[model samples]
Target chain A: MDMVRNFHMAQGLGETSYAQNSPLQKEVIESVMDITLRSAMEACAAETVSIADLGCSSGRNTLSVVENVIRAVCERRREATQQLPEFMVFLNDLPSNDFNTLFSLVPEFVQKLKAEHDDGGGILVSVAGAPGNFYGRLFPSSSLHFITSFTSLHWLSQVPAGLLNNEESVNKGNIYMSPASPPLVATLYFERFQKDFNMFLRSRSQELVVGGKMVFSFIGRRSHDSHEKINECLLLEALEKSLSILVSQKLVTEEKLDSFNLPFYAPSTQELEDQVYREGSFTIDSMKQAHDWTIHEYAPKMLSNFSRAIIESFICHHFGEEIIEPLFETYTQLLCEKLVAREDIGWSKIIVVLCKSAAS
Target chain B: MDMVRNFHMAQGLGETSYAQNSPLQKEVIESVMDITLRSAMEACAAETVSIADLGCSSGRNTLSVVENVIRAVCERRREATQQLPEFMVFLNDLPSNDFNTLFSLVPEFVQKLKAEHDDGGGILVSVAGAPGNFYGRLFPSSSLHFITSFTSLHWLSQVPAGLLNNEESVNKGNIYMSPASPPLVATLYFERFQKDFNMFLRSRSQELVVGGKMVFSFIGRRSHDSHEKINECLLLEALEKSLSILVSQKLVTEEKLDSFNLPFYAPSTQELEDQVYREGSFTIDSMKQAHDWTIHEYAPKMLSNFSRAIIESFICHHFGEEIIEPLFETYTQLLCEKLVAREDIGWSKIIVVLCKSAAS
Candidate 1:
């Protein structure tokens, strides 16, 4: 989870150019954000409205997506000649995120917005900073008009506990994601995520009045089955390879290396759907399995860089700093190998837009 | 190429188990061997003969395959016992190959062969210690009846020259079989393999009687086009991953890692067929692609072991040995990432058995 946060931080700081360029990411974000903004406008019946980017990484793309959503909603509202509501924006990320870096570039963004609005003749627009963890409560009730979180939310706050026990019975030597890891590890992680996610929804449900809409984009597996080789085997294998190098070099002892596993898990679209559905606070407006190539083509460098940054600094904090270089070398090599091997085997960042409305 | 050799060598030690477990491999080899053997028997029409297993890794499986061929012929010979001559047998492999390992268990094999023979069981089975590469020249001309080499002949005597001329623009920076890598890398590797393979055929062509047949299996790709990702990308990715790890660890240094490339080219079945047809000396009676489960199921392990045994030990021997563990770790990690992300994506090892009819 920390790794994911760090990655998103780096991504927000213009590090995800690789991801933005990806047709898959671009298309899905555009489509879902489009639908989301439309729903927000319809539900609120506002000619213009405020939008919040929750866990907004430091990327121009995030704001760009919001800008497109705002424009989409405003354009539709103009047809009704409804008085335009003031447009306010808030960019939220972890307090530790590089918001300073993000803040530095905001002037230009505001200037561009003003320039466009001035040229079009009249619309009040406001943008603010909200740096905090999404897992805990952050916003005021009934404050947000619309919310967007692209390529976030799948991350847990931490790696699930006891996953790295690596006992002999557990076959820790190479048990990447055995069919028999007992769902305990996954269940624990999911439960925590559920708690956090439910809190996020409850918080958002309160902040969004009666019908504000929220849209999110995140990484997900194609299947819900944990034993699926691609889900468990591939990433673990890469990690194993990196560890092997560390062991071979005698930098990290074989024993220390054998007793570790990664913390994050990307659920499938169905799993995400079920969680949202069970929450029962938000009505599912739309969902989709985003095209993978879109993400790959856009974030080539960032994909590799973001992954390394998280692994080294956040995910496995126990890993010695000296091992970072070797770890990255191993990690990047594995990533490139995968990219070149299969065409359809790219990352999937899903988009889900929902409206917070009471059951009829 | 070295990887291929080591894999063959390891499986050679337990060929029976491998054949029994890997049905596709067994079927592929059997199909080709059967056709070639039948062609040889029909062409020979001789009452008696001597059969030899050349470059036959170390396994009773080779004898089993050969025994089937001899028995089928012997059954025909038994139909005319008055004109039958006793059959002689010889099994061969490299000096480095565990022949003693094979010798320890040969009694059972011989007894099985003798007991199976009908005519007073006078099948003179001889196990010879002819240990040399089949690439250059090994057997005496016109001295053998049947020749067989299962899963051999595709490997070049050594990593091809001109594959890693770093000075060349195309040869820069860890490119293996790159679309842009010096035309010579692929050409040289292919030329060397062709040269060595043709020599193998010529040696066998001369050594075998007018009706002699040779059965062999080696690695081959599913496509002739350079765009094929199987050979070009997957293998190169592994090499690159290894080098990247070495680079990160500062073991090989970036410059040296940049200049290294493995000396191997797994041709497509079509390409192999074309080569044999061009030789004209040996008619390709049958050709098939063998399933390599060991390569598929235990690829990371098998590939790592292969690199240690052949590649790391031979080619790129200049690279510091201290980084091997790190290098392999990077390689495996990259491979693992690719594997886990997908359900099933692997390679098809090709098996081809040809016949040399004095008439051809």
Candidate 2:
């Protein structure tokens, strides 16, 4: 999980592109609209404001997030009888993300912005792509004024180091931090999250000015225990079952499946808050949890496509590309059948807004 | 024509990966041994030597080129009784390249470097990937020392602007600057190359320090005319013929076929020399031509895979992925059949070594 090298959203603008399959992320973006706007408004003092959307994978939502920030800052300026500032927007992602589709929409976006502010207000929008992982520094010091990331922090920098072939068989059949795993496996995942999340905060704090604000939303659970009843792990459980089926049929090796682990951790709100406090760079302004996704009629298929877009490169790297079509077919069928009986299975997302402390 | 955004070498280490299909490029790298060694020996005076390889598509060859540069620099230091300087190597390519496969081999590359040196030789090697096109600025001012690009400068920054759907109905069936193409179509391709090559030289001039050297090799023609007996353009001709057959079968649309154009231009030796003089930054140290390849055994499908690895993402963007398998099959069949009667067909490569002028 050298995230920059190993990960990519699916390529191009076809039926399987991340742009076409990312409605869940779009919905979550809309869910945090108020928080994103308020933070942008608070940081509208500069004549040139910079906004970054970390892990802004390929799609219309990439620009949609930037649009929300622009509108928020513009409205605040109008309310205060001030002129709009020129915007510098950076769309950040891993090196493997499909930047072509993201750039294809720029012409129309620029035209729409010009038409909306047609009074010769002279506001300029300059967009550039910064391709790298957000767990490290991507911008110059004190350069980013406002930053946002959606549904992306769950991906750690790498898989936890200690989980490979332990004597006690930790995370043997499981691919992620699931309810069926023992408590020690869960602790290893949490420790990795703490390390990664701390580095992310440290890097962003160095890049942001003293008064800059960051708003992020990612998957988490309401309960702090590993055996909690959350759908995040259950969805992984279903996919793991599909992979195990492939292994049993001699289509995939059991050893290959055992070595593969998803670099993900769904933390609780208290865990995130604790890390934020210990990291000592930013203060939380607000935190909200929404238990929105469940195994409903559309959720299973939608989740399959979403998972396929994000994780297919990693899986195809381990399992050859020849197996991809059959593998996904079997996984989708199993996911649809499993959702019929698991009404209590769903995941919660936690959104937090924070401000960089001047005295830290 | 957005090279960084659209073009990519294939992904993974599997059968279709560029890693498995690039033996021809590896052979070409070995053929340029003397020039690479001479350039490294001349620049052994600095404590930090910077080297860049443009169009460094994924494979064993990418690292093999860097290994050659490092070894040359080290051997130069050993001969002169001087200490080894810290080396910074930059491998550049299109943004969509399979960098995961490239980065995965880093640990072993480093291990091999250390084992050979063995004395506490203070020879630190740092490798970083700069993902973008070489036709524009990719590095800071006066930052590069030695640069090498192989088999890639023939790609224009874009398809020449004037050749699309013109009223003359010229180049109607042809896909490239070939014997079948009208003279005007050939002129347009040359003009585009002239502009792009001029820009490339101008940008590199600003990046390299005075007396710094650049070595680049690309596919070219001995004659200035496109109608000459060169196999490079003929190879494309056969593929275009295969695509046309598919169009006749209604498998691929005529409109789609008509819209496609390869962003390539094969220049003559004098053409490159003229541009180098006009750009006024570097002086040609040496230029050599080798007519190396023709359609023989292992050349047909080998060319197809080489083309596919470079152009598949672009083709899959326009035509659906379903056409890929059948398309290559028909293409391989046509190429094999055409190669039977043509014995004089071959591609000539022109390698030029240049040094930056001391005066602006």
Candidate 3:
């Protein structure tokens, strides 16, 4: 998933406005935190609980969401006793994520949260960091009572291998999920998503306690066909154009260029539901499609970083820096063309909050 | 001139954002008024003088600039006679303009102005309409004391006949300013601008009274060399692409589509200065380039309405309404592509305030 790595690196250089400005995610996550923590407080009948945000890049937003959850839990606990529970938060992300950036701001965030809760007069909150990919396993099993991942998930470590292979379904001209392209690319895309999603459920099932709750939000397509409106498809087209420009310019050998494709695909809402149901280990409590968004509010920054961090680095790493500028310009032009053509109706994000089944 | 007609119609609908967000223009023109009116009041040495906004479409922004000028002049006059001049305003546009739209709001505007001025004691102001193009002569000679046009003067009523007749120049394609195009297009564009501009000045010379300050703030480019940036050329290329799509769909005949070109040209700062100096009529006191602005802000809306107002009624008049949507989409896509591809540098604006040379 060098593609994923590149994407993160590139998008990190500039402001990821979408991640920063998603009031929708912020509001929804806050509500989810309140609901889930209140339920946890009632179920545990314990003094306090720990919440973990797995794959929490920068950890700032993660701490915020967890703070809200703790507040709600403590508010409920305060109803019965004069003393409040001491809450702990573990913020996790890839090891390479700017943990220092997150840590530097931790003191300020903690102080602010303390001041806010000072009036309530009892709850104590502490935050810790755990930097690792959630796919392999990050946190200790049964350690996290409540977990959340907003605007993440749905991303596999890499593009599904079957998509790149011809024998399996869903391959079209070595291109996948682009506009004015064959339908098979989209089909292959969705099938791969189904496989990866099953893996996510299996992994999450092993990590969570029987009563643990996990909330995940991810990018998705509006329709179930999967043959249309795939988010990653547009990004791939941009990469393809950039690659072709590289090959034509002789920046990279044609063989090296042809051997790779980006490893991301946004699943459809119906397809996601189907995947989770098949896992059978977890019971979904709630799932909602965040179909509409203000891309202008977030896209420009995300895209700027995506081009610089991922595309430029990928091209430079494989070939050299010679083709970087051309590749970026071509990629940006292609992306803008696709965006305007789509009229900004490109991606649908899905939010799902689920609990491990009693049987499991 | 029909092209200019299209521009005037589209100015409000597609080609100009200023028409919709008058407040933006109001901010700039208000400052210009503050400067010009102070100078005009000083030049005339009169306590009270009339002010008019030439080609002030819908009179919204014109009223604002006028109101500000009147208020300022009254403030100055209060120091002397304790009376404000009987301020009269003439909001001018073409016969085809939305006069009813302008008139409907006049009562409220006048009442508000009166109320604001009344609070400052006694500053009388009355407003009326001038429904005619400034190009052909709107006001009676020497009848007005002060006039301001925030951003309307760069437009010529028609593309220059010299450039239109020169097949070589016209055939080069996009015979106006556009970035990333041939230098010849800018050369031809400026040459044509010189001719039409000479006419513009020759005409304006007869309209303004001695010491009457007319300010023209409009879209312009940075470089004197038309070769470097030809924004207008890009706009036409986009239009040609749209036309090509029409020909492919057999929506319009190739010959008819081929003959058409846009009439508007955004001039550079030097070009405006040269034209004013060559006119031997108006003496430019101050010319400053305002912030760069995108024509795309208004062009999309204007292009949408072009079919109903002019193109459908003229070029594609025989074609069914079914062709309209496709034409617009095709046009917008092409324009957006061209715009997105180039350096995000072209499409700027300039504001110049000139006084009719008393010596002339």
Best candidate, lDDT-wise? 2
Question: Candidate 1, residues B1-360: lDDT per residue as tens digits?
Answer: 343223234323342223223333344456566565675566446544656666555445566676677667767767766444445455555444544344444445555766777456345443333444566444444556667665555456665666545454345565456565555566776777787667766667766776566666666777776444554245456667667666676677666766565555677887787778777777776677754443456556554554444344433355755766677677777777766665445456666657676675
CA lDDT scores, all candidates in order:
0.58, 0.78, 0.58
> Which pairs, if any, clash in model 2?
A231-A346
List the per-model TM-score of the A chain: 0.81, 0.95, 0.77
Across A1-360, the per-residue lDDT of candidate 2 in tens digits comes to: 566676878877888888898887888999898878888889657877878889988799979888878877877888898877777677778766765567556546655775776666445565555566788766656767999999899888888888875633467777887776778778889899999999999989977899999999998888877677556666677788889998898898878787778888988999999999999999999988888753464656677887788888888887878777777788888878878766766678999999999977
Better of 2 and 3 by TM-score: 2
What is the lDDT for A66 in model 1? 62
> In model 1, what lDDT does residue B117 have?
73
- Candidate that scores best on DockQ: 2
lDDT of 3 by residue, B115-211 (tens): 8777554444434444444554444345456666655655556555554454434433232344543555456556666776677666566556777
Model 3 gets an lDDT of 0.58
lDDT of 3 by residue, A1-360 (tens): 443233333222135322343354455456456445655564333444656676665434676776667667767656876566556566655444444345445555666767877865534454555433556444334445677786657556666575545543344324345564456556666666666678777767766778777877766777776555455345566677767776777765666665555555777777777888888878877787765544445454356444454334445555577766666666777666767776654456677778877787
Cα lDDT tens digits for candidate 1, A1-360 = 343233333333343333332333445566676566666666656533657788665546566776666566666667776554456566766544544344445445655765665535455444444544666544545556688886667666555555555452233443234344555655655666667677777768866756788888777767776556553234445666767777788887766665555555567777777777777888888887754554345333445565553444442455566787677677677767765775655556667778888761
Question: Tens digit of lDDT per residue, candidate 2, span B141-199?
Answer: 56678988988898898877787856333567666786777788888899999999998
10 residues in a row with least lDDT, candidate 1 chain A: A12-21
**Candidate 1 vs candidate 2, DockQ winner:** 2
